[model samples]
Target: MTVVTKPKAQPRAFISLRSSVDFVVTSTTSEIIDRALGYLRAGFPVHFRGPAGTGKTTLALHIAAQLDRPVMLMVGDEQLTSSDLVGEQNGYRYRRVVDRYIHSVVKYEEDAVQNWVDNRLTTACREGFTLVYDEFTRSRPEANNVLLAALEERVLVLPTSNGANAYVKVHPDFRAIFTSNPQEYAGVHDAPDALSDRLVTMDLDYYDRPTEISITASNSGLDLAEVERVVDIVREFRDSGEYDQAPTLRACIMIARVSALQGIRPSLGDKRFVQICLDVLESKTAYTSKNRDRRTAQRKMLVQMIDHHMAHPLDAERV
Candidate 1:
């Protein structure tokens, strides 16, 4: 007779997310984050709901970091499923044993069994890791049905085939953060009311002008005055409702950074600077009408916007 010991399997590495160091935390941003943290620490999951460029996903990661736990990040997809959330039987694990009763004779036995793997959600629940599910509504609602009980009952019901461990007791330190675009946005699916009832949703809008300018200045390596000029034009364009898509703070930063790198000032006096502003802002509308000259009209409007903010040399003196 022979005896053997199974070696221990090493634990898999937990997922790591890069720090949100570049995330500009202004007064308004701080307030939103604090409120979301309050909800999360109180044993309720937090949801940041807003349109595109509203920083929902970024805010979710920021809040998850404050929980002081290892984080698991999940990007929602249309192909996700309940098994994808919990555990599923994968290929198989095989074992072989050889017995030598006498010097002249030997016998062999082999066994194989299905391997089960825990997906991100299940691992987060069992190990008490913070979960950041970005663009969760992009996943089909049926795929997310597994979350209902986990959020409400503090228990995760697993498939019976998982055998003795058919359910996971939600860890006391477990927390989940979710982000999603508005239901009207393309490729965004409507979340179920049952799941929505479990979350404390915070609807985010674009940062106010002061915050936008501050963020642009920090990210673009541009002076406050220059950033203000760029942000002002973008904000004006956003408010005018003259385009297919609204311009965002991202647009402001894009213009500011490129101009700064190229040694172009944000001034109407410089033709290159004027062209940069038009190029960054004009792409939003993309007019292709042969009948009417929408491009000419919008170009005229955008130039007027730039002239309002950057044409004045005195604006620099005030800054």
Candidate 2:
């Protein structure tokens, strides 16, 4: 994470979608996108399930944007509740009236009522905004129970709400995209069977080699050839299954982007580049001071692995 002459301002590591020209589209991603879009068009809520760093959230956002609708983004949390997704009555609204027509008698009336405010889910269902619920499994399953009817019956049931607002008919244009990391279990809950049945789930994994190279190059502003080196080393390290946490394409972008900013090449001959690789990838291990020996051993292996990959060029093939 260290750089020689640190960037004074935030680095533009990524060139975001400015137009169709800047959009990162490849045959691999296009197929996935078209498939997800098709399910969505068929009136099914699409779920992107995967392990961490698989681009689930990014792909969800891209698909949502393609729908040409205003998007509502909500991140699931351990403390999230149904009221957090839908609306809830918090404060009270009060009104008072005094009778002036009766000269002989005075009358006064007062009433207090609870106020209901729409939350992200309620608003999206009511206004037809596309909802991208990221990492939804992190929220308690009970909290997400509200989505069952919203996704299935095309209505949001407000059991606690009273009056004509008891239920909201979901807008025709309303759509939902959910992303979750199944490998995360500490705070994440299992997807409810009912909820899972309602969604068109798409399990995802790392993209092919060319897609990774294109994404890294596009995001880091590094040329494809240099980006390929960083990707190859990291991908090989991941496949080795030696690290506690596997390095994803994100790791590749970090090395390439930072090296480019510092005018360093992604070559083992450059000490700075090698350090950057270790700094980016080695810490992904589970080693701590309790096992400094293991940490050092992994560090040496990472360096040797980098040298090996840099020395032997991998053929341009799907990995």
Candidate 3:
């Protein structure tokens, strides 16, 4: 008799092509991969905190993809309810009815099933999918109270229409990942200590120079020289402390793309390109009359950066 053997499953690629399409812009870094692996191995909920435009959402999505799990995403808001995280019961519907006439009063009872629980957390737990809660702390801390037990004990105590006695248990394979800006940013809430203790927070910083330039070049369709120039300019501004808020690689890519679209070339004489950098810095920093001198110094530094870029084209290649 001949026996058939099952084929072994091949390992998934580190970076899937489908996952790449999810984020049009991303700053690739080894730290991101390390954090993803840490979460996967530790079996703990992971939280990503960073400044705005630092690709926290993109990183979360990429990590979810790397885990090779179905992703259920929730964008937190102030109006979010427990039902939004757990589940709610809609009105009951009667599918079958039988009537028998008798001398006594007819007996009737309603039958119901608590089967429809729809929410990111509930569905992820029930289906053993990866849950991405973006800007989770933006909502009231009370809204996430339903998640405490689910995240800690791997069991979701859901509310059902039957009564307080009804609840749904979470599946064992579920995992959660969260991403949010720093609490100092507007519209962010301080994460409750209870929830914070349950998660491993990975504070993400801006991408290092080479990675930033590569990401900007790949996404912006700009030459490496142009990408490096933009990176250098931003890095100088950040290191010099001329601008209170440093422009992110994302901002640099935007400026490059806009410059290219406007027929601006990579040259020091490009006033429009310089203006783009100024606009990014001005919009990101809180302007005040007291910092007028600082602003002027920043503009001078920006001009010097442009001149340096034009004078030494080979310097842009190093990044």
The TM-score leader among the candidates is 1
- Cα-based lDDT at residue 73, candidate 2: 89
Error of 1 at 312 (Å): 1.9
Better of 2 and 3 by lDDT: 2
Show model 1 residue runs off by greater than 4 Å: 1-21, 102-108, 286-292, 314-319
Assess the local accuracy of residue 163 in candidate 1 as a C-alpha lDDT between 0 and 100. Answer: 57
Lowest summed lDDT over 10 consecutive residues: which window, candidate 3? Answer: 8-17
Q: Per-prediction RMSD in angstroms?
A: 2.5, 10.8, 9.1
Order of models, best TM-score first: 1, 2, 3
Q: Give each model's clash number.
A: 0, 0, 0
Summing lDDT over every window of 10 consecutive residues in candidate 1, give the lowest-scoring window: 1-10
- Compared with the true structure, model 2 gives a TM-score of 0.88
Query: How does model 1 score by TM-score?
Result: 0.91
User: Scored by CA lDDT, what does every candidate get?
Assistant: 0.86, 0.84, 0.73
Per-residue CA lDDT of candidate 3, range 1-319, in tens? 2222333443322223255421343345555767666876678889989987677887787777777877788898989988888767744443333344564655454455434546677778777888889999899999998889988877777776455435557766677889988988788899999999998898888877877777777777767778788788777766766555557877878877777677676677667777887777556556789988767776777778768766774554346
Question: What are the TM-scores, per candidate, against the unseen true structure?
Answer: 0.91, 0.88, 0.80
Worst 10 residues of 2 by lDDT: 10-19
TM-score (C-alpha) between model 3 and the true structure:
0.80
Q: Can you list the residue pairs that collide in candidate 2?
A: none
